[model samples]
Target chain A: MIGAVPARDATLAERLRAGRSPRRRAVDRAGRGLALAATLACVVPLAAVLFFVVAKGAGALNLDLLTKPAKALGTGGGALQSWLGTVQMVGLATLIAVPVGIAAGIYVSEFAGHRAARAIRFASDVMVGVPSILVGIFVYVLLVLPFRQFNAFAGSVALAVIIVPVIQRTTEEVLGLVPRELREGSLALGVPSWRTTLSVVLPTARAGVLTGVMLGVARAAGETAPLLFTALGSRLVNIGGFGEPMDSLTLFIYNGARSPIAALNDQAWGAALLLLLLVLGINVSVRLRSMGGVRA
Target chain B: MREDPVEMSVAAPVAAPPEPQREALPTAPSTVPGGAPLSLAPPAAGIPGAAPATVPAAKIEIRDLNLYYGPFRAVRDVSMGIAANQITAIIGPSGCGKSTFLRSINRMHELTRHASMDGQVLLDGVDVYSPEVDAVDLRRFVGMVFQRPNPFPTMSIYDNVVAGLRLGGGARKADLDEVVERCLRAAGLWDEVKDKLRAGGTSLSGGQQQRLCIARALAVDPEVILMDEPASALDPVATLRIEELMLELRGRFTIVIVTHNMQQASRVSDFTAFFSMGEDRAGYLVEMDRTARIFTNPREKLTEDYVSGRFG
Candidate 1:
């Protein structure tokens, strides 16, 4: 059995029992509806793209598509050469970009003086905003012109240039979030500044840094314009060396999409789906691993 | 802890002395390598209450120290001797440069951008700021604990304790294990954390985390430990435990603690230095004396007023 509630509790219960006025309730519902509409505005385009890609590309998938190289105009072979080139070029680009990007990030966040840090940050921002095609042209002039060849190395260089600024900015932001207290604590224990940064600061921001790297990798893997000037798409596989022309999934999609034949266009859709899945798979796996990765 | 003030107050009246006494130098002046002469005489200006009472052994001597953050003076003209094997508490209100003064002892203050200090902070009679001394090397001799518990989030309980030792280069696993156990026990956290030495440092509660930070500070075996309000974030019970830990460790290390809690200063410290901000917003030492005398019968009117709750 319950006894009489205290005066304060009684008042609180009475207040709880009261409902908002009709005008206020209507306003609340309208606000919630607006929020839902805004959310759908963001999600609808993404859902539509995924739905159409799967619908159009699923029938094009086959063993032949996987096994054969590109055939002549209108006729189909496969994206074997393109897939391999993408793997090699993007892989090399990652190797070049990650270390340089992370090092530059660390310098800006942990070591650079005020004016120097500002200048570096400004340069990175400007690099990020520069058009991807311009990066391709820049690399063409820098590496292609100097070497007298449109080679996979120049394509990888352009991709790496594109990736570096994205990774650098993200790394700097993530490292900035690592608390100042952690650095001070480590330094007070007689650990040098550089050691503290490597051990304590970086590890704490590991998951975030990995996320940034994945974003950079995904962007580099999908870039077609940059590869156009440098890689100069090849129908035959060029796997012997970086000095030869290369074919990537983006180039395959570009060529197939523009072809007059319906079959090549379908294959283009298939390759787009494949590239999207590959990037998605890498991102999902990395996110899951990082979630369970380190306590920091 | 409640009974502490009562017992100390009873002893306070009996322990009062008529005149202030200077702390005797702990060791001979020759111990200062490079023959840096020890200035035995008090400062010529003889700032009031600067040297109010005696301490057992002087471990660190600060002479004419003025700390600046860019153009603003934070701590001005502080001269004092921190006693070895004892806890010296620095008490002041907010923005009074209490933490700045503590950081200067370990040269941690210089880590802040635009932060600088002149005059001498002598560790074993050698100026720590001398061109020959490396700040990194000097930090090995003086460890510090911040107000917030900052156990490395990336490390486990055991790893956090050995983070400092790991820097000197790899040590035998057995040696690290021993250091971990010894420091945890010294911080009064061994029994609670021993079973889960591999657990994340952040898995512990607020109180336990603070104790872990203390254990981390102790791991390097520094001769002096500086605490900047180490327990201000904890509950009263945890605060008492930290105070007890400081008291127990006083026999082995020189401890300089900056606290906002007056009762904590009166309870845990052997010597108390009261700091107050001047009109220009620069903090300076108002009085330094035995804990008992400083609380019971301070010589300066400002010290008495602040202690009695008349004003800050």
Candidate 2:
């Protein structure tokens, strides 16, 4: 406006000409079909899995299935031990993983020099790629044999090792999303670096960090291979004290799903449903909190 | 790009939230100073410039300063003396290092990796670049407002204003209320926001948010306030309001502003420094003079070209 130039005539490209050519419409149709195929390719499998799982497990659930312990190798039993054991180990692992993981994330994102932080982040990404079974074995040898017994604690240690890198990497990435302006605003107030990170950076990224934490917890909860060598499933509802063998839904499903017994098969379906629900619950809660934060 | 703060329509329903009041801001929160948290309606004696001991001297002196980002030298040896309780405007085209020079006052440029500098920034004749002078404490005496309005998205309006005090710690509620009102009043934002102090800082309009950022800076009672294109994102009306607030703030805080608008520099500043980058693209000051002289009759040909809109 200040320069005072006259408006030019509209170019052909700008005069509502998009999607008018026959070739354009054909390309558009192709793109739509391909995208639909891709979407269905993913959604079909997921929907089938949900349907099959529900169909198989729906009739299997009763109060007994949840409240009673497995008897005679998961035949005519409720899977109570597996439920309790899954809760304990996942809960324990989350307790151990969350603090250390978040701290490492903060250090990598905020404090470490570029090269050093990159090295750590690279290691974390590689750690994520490491086979879960190998993590189980590493913990099995380091924790299990040294403690001279199988125990829930050993399983927790293994799960926590697997969870740490995921949460740490996620936290670093999520914290990175917090704009530099907020960090500068805090620091420019004469607030110390540490205080700035805690009060401003962390709080600003609260919803995202919670997503990372929940993802780690959900991952640790359902893992079968990691607990296989460490937890060593039990039939009774033991608290699975530090050195005691424990039970988990994944352990139950792995062994039961392969068996010929009809009752054990049904129990496996129920266990799968339960684990799926738990993960779903965690994901839904994360979404709700994120939405609430935005709305507020 | 400049915007004109479009005044809201005069005809409004009864339930609408309070708009910016044109008349005088609500009186002193209508309560005693340092008393309760203004229950019904709705105060900076400790401010650095208030003392005669600290007045009438150069507040900040930048000497032989060079700033670098890794191997690229962005700013070359530039020197300037800023008088206390006066507004100095820094004007330049884009990428001219005016913003970089402003950031050096509070040592904010050092926050980025590989950003290094060689300079002496003296506050009250004490070198801020010396190892013993903590950057954190130095910022309290010299505050900054950014080009874009960046109120913390998570914090409420009142929280954003008092954030500096809370970070310093040991502040009572009564003290916080007083600072909030005083700072908001100084920024010319008290009347629009006092009722919705608990609302998110981001809920305010763009112009109001910029003013909120100003209030946040003023709450620290900074000896010097550095603003980097503070009105660049606002409407013309909002820009004018900020300009008026700058004049009102004269004598309470030594102000240094970086702006691209030559008219704004001529209108508001007591002294004007013109900066431009040369062949190597490293910005350096071309001229520094009283505002009237710089705008009407500058000694440097480059300054004349920039001011007369012949060249940038």
Best by DockQ: 1
Q: What is candidate 2's CA lDDT for residue B280?
A: 90
lDDT of 2 by residue, A165-275 (tens): 998998899899988988888788787899888888887888878888888988898798989889888888878475899999899888889999988898889888887
Which sections of candidate 2 miss by over 4 Å? A1-27, A72-74, A286-296, B1-56
Q: Against the true structure, what is model 2's DockQ?
A: 0.39
| lDDT per residue as tens, model 1, A83-192 | 88988899999999999999999999998999999999999999999999999999999989888888999999999999999899999999999999999999998898
Clashes of each: 0, 10
Worst 10 residues of 1 chain A by lDDT: A1-10
DockQ scores for all predicted structures: 0.55, 0.39
Task: Give the poorly placed runs of model 1, Cα more than 4 Å off.
Answer: A1-29, A72-74, B1-47, B50-53, B168-174
Tens digits of per-residue lDDT for model 2 on B215-295?
Answer: 988776666889999999999999999998887776556789999898998888877889999889999888776678789
- lDDT value, residue A276 of candidate 2: 81
